[model samples]
Target: MEKQRNVLQVNGLNVAVKSAQGMLPLVQNLQFELKPGKILGLVGESGSGKTITSMALLQLLNQKTMNVEGSIQLHGRELNGLKEKEMRGIRGKDIGFIMQNPMNAFTPVYTIGNQFVETIRIHTKLSKKQAIDLAIASLEKMNLQEPSKIMKMYPFQLSGGMLQRVMIAISMCLRPSVVIADEPTTALDVTTQLQVLRELDRLRTECGTAILLISHDLGVISELADEVAVMQKGRIVEKADVYRLFDHPQHDYTKKLLQARPVLSVNEELSKLVI
Candidate 1:
């Protein structure tokens, strides 16, 4: 079998913001490759530039305020300096995004089904009837109950968790080759968080989505990431396989992060007893 091409690659990426306050560097010398169906978790605290790195890949950061350098290639093609119209096509057609807050993304004016159908029509060459059917099917895939009712309700009418399910459904409908999930499940409580994250993992397994998952939660990273990139003050201090990073963290900062995270998993439970 032929080796699969990488879905996304970033090399020596630098992102900086300019303001009256001064030029503040966000991300520097960041490099990573995301293969098809694998998830690389960008783990860091706030102000560490995890979200800035994600924005740089698609050129989504405000051009007037932020300047970015280095190569961000998708499937062997360089994305740097791509026109906005070109990037728009790639944003949803080839790469999907699940934002941190569903409310921030979900339009309150449109019914869920209408918005979903619109998304399907925009990304896919499908008739209105076909789009509606596809939208409903996507909702079902998210394991949502009363899918029909959800399809008809507006964003404000649904709960946070329900709205999140709708957002996930929208992102997964076309099975974009790359998915950028930026703190997607952080708004939920523990039980709902598990449900959402597990569903995200399931989607990756089924759809071959190469994910750039951003989250400060180590427990969440342990559950979903194949690889981990530890970020601090705009740079990745360590990048390693998940198991190795957890078992033998080479950097002091990485080890401190691991130590700070509360023990939550069965593996950690066993380790506690062994210790």
Candidate 2:
């Protein structure tokens, strides 16, 4: 057996926003790679440039207001500075993105079926009817009940967890090589979060999809990520295997983050809350 090649690679990546002084860097000299069927968790606090890094990879940054420098390669294909039209074709078809807010993933006015079918048709040659069937099957895989009925509904008609699963269903339907899940379970309850995480795990195991999991939650990172990258002040301070990073964090910031995880009281004793 041979080791799988990296599905996504970032080297010397930097993102900057125009300011009065000059181009202010948000992410600097970032470097990492995500292999097929592996999850690389990017953990950081707010304003640490985690989200910006994701956006830069997807070529979603506003070119007029922001500048993304360095290499962002997907399966050896360079993505940096691609035209919007070219990027559009790659966004959902090659690299799937699961946003923090499920509501942001869909439009409120369109029927779910309509949006799903259109998206599928755009990337594939399937007829509308065939696309709908594929969509329903994808939803069923996520354990969404009454998939047919749900298709007729609007985005606002569903719960947050349902919508999140729906987004996952859509992403999986395309079988993207890489999936960038940015705080995907943030709005869901504990049980729902578990479901989402499990689904992500299934995606990797079953379909060999590489994932970039970005979250501020150490617990989430610990549970789902094979490797972890700790970000602070717009730079990756440390990168290590999940277990090693947790047990023997080298960076001071990494240690601080581990210490910051919430603790629970057990028989009048404080115990670190386990994921």
Candidate 3:
């Protein structure tokens, strides 16, 4: 079989913000790629520049106050300087966003059905009824019982877990070639988080969707990432396969992160945590 090329390429990336005092670098010299049917984990704690990287790739930045330098190529096309109108076409249709908090991206005034239909209509040639049917079907795949009721309900009516699934469904409705899932499971309960991850795994396998999975949770990365990139202080400190990264981390930060994961069994936990 012929090898598929990179769907997203980021190189020489730098992001900085301007304040009253001076310039502050948020992400420095970051570089990576995502091929079809693979997941690249962007792992780091809060304010470590993980979210900034994704926004940079999609050209979603406040250009007036920020200084961004880099090349972000999606399907062989550069995205660095595209106009907002030009970027809009690609944002949802070619590249989907599963935000850390789904509610942050959702509108309080609209029903789930309204938002879903609007999203579908933006990227595809679909009528109101067509989009509505697709939305209901997508909700069903999330294992939501009485999916129709959820569709009629407003954003405030649903739990965080439910909203997360809705965001996933909305993002994938266009079958985007790449999905930027930023802390997608952060707000969910443990069991719900597992379910969401499993659903994402299924989506990746079944549809060959390229994923940029960003989170502070190493356990989440261990469960889904094909390759891991460890970030610290706005730069990638080390990167390796999940198992190798866990067993033999090169950087002190990476090593410290591994040490923080709780052991599963009580005996193992006791042994590892012995005073």
Candidate 4:
């Protein structure tokens, strides 16, 4: 059988922002590929360009003050330099994004049901009723309680974990080819973090959705990622399978990061997360 093609491909990606000093690079020559049903964890400390890379892929960076160069392809379609109208069509349908702050994903003025239903109708031909049904079902699949009641609530009414899962439900309902989860579990408690991670894992296993999992947490990376890419100072310093990267990291930065965390905790969490 022929090998399956990658679901998402990023190559030679560079992002720079304007400054008094001149163009300051936020991400430099970043490159990675994500196959269907696979999670490629992008791990780095704060200011390591992980979030910038995601913004570039989603074409969300402000062009007025920033420059994003090189290829960001989904299902072999070039996304760089596309018009905003064109990108809008692709953003939720072809690729989904889950941000660290669930509140950012939602508008305060809108009820959860309104945003969820509207998002569904935007990318698909589903009617309002159908969209509501799908939205509720998706939330239920995430193990959320009282999906209907939750939908009636506004963004402010839900807890952080509930809001995050609702966001995941919205992202996964469309079954996008890839999902970019940027620091998704950062604000959640340990139990909520595991719940979110498990939902993401389910997205891959059940729906074949590729995921770009970006977090500074190695334990989280070890739990979900099939492969890991270590980023430092706006560049990828190392990329490897999860086990290998943790067991015998080659990069000095990677080594230092691992040494900084407790091995037993990571391993215990990894065991719980791995199916």
User: Candidate 1: where are CA atoms >4 Å away?
Assistant: 264-275
Model 2 reaches what TM-score against the true structure? 0.96
Candidate 2 at 26: error in angstroms? 0.4
In the range 1-275, model 2's lDDT, one tens digit per residue, is: 99778899899998999999999999999999999999999998998999999999999989999999999889899999888999999988999999999999998889999888989999999988899999999999999999999999999999999999999999889999999999999979999999999999999999999999999999999999999999999999999999999999999999999999998669556344443
Candidate 3 stretches with Cα past 4 Å from truth are 268-275
* 1-275: candidate 4 lDDT, tens digit per residue: 99989998899999999999999999999889999999999999999999989999999999999999999888889999999999999988889999999998899999999999999999999889999999999999999999999889999999999999999999889999999999999989999999999999988999899999999998899999999999999999999999999999999999999988864678888899999
Model 1 weakest lDDT span, ten residues long:
261-270
The candidate that wins on TM-score is: 2
Candidate 3 lDDT over residue span 1-275, tens digit each:
98889999999999999998899899999989997889999997788899999999888889988889989999999999988998999998999999998899899999998998899998889888898999999999989889889989999999999999999999887888999999999979998898899889988898899999999888889889999999998999998887888778899999888888877798977898888
- Which residue segments of model 2 deviate by more than 4 Å? 265-275
What is the full ranking by TM-score, best candidate first?
2, 4, 3, 1
List per-prediction Cα lDDT, in the order shown.
0.89, 0.94, 0.90, 0.94
TM match of model 4 to true structure? 0.95
Model 3 clashing residue pairs (backbone):
none
Number of the candidate with higher TM-score, 1 or 3? 3
Worst 10 residues of 2 by lDDT: 266-275
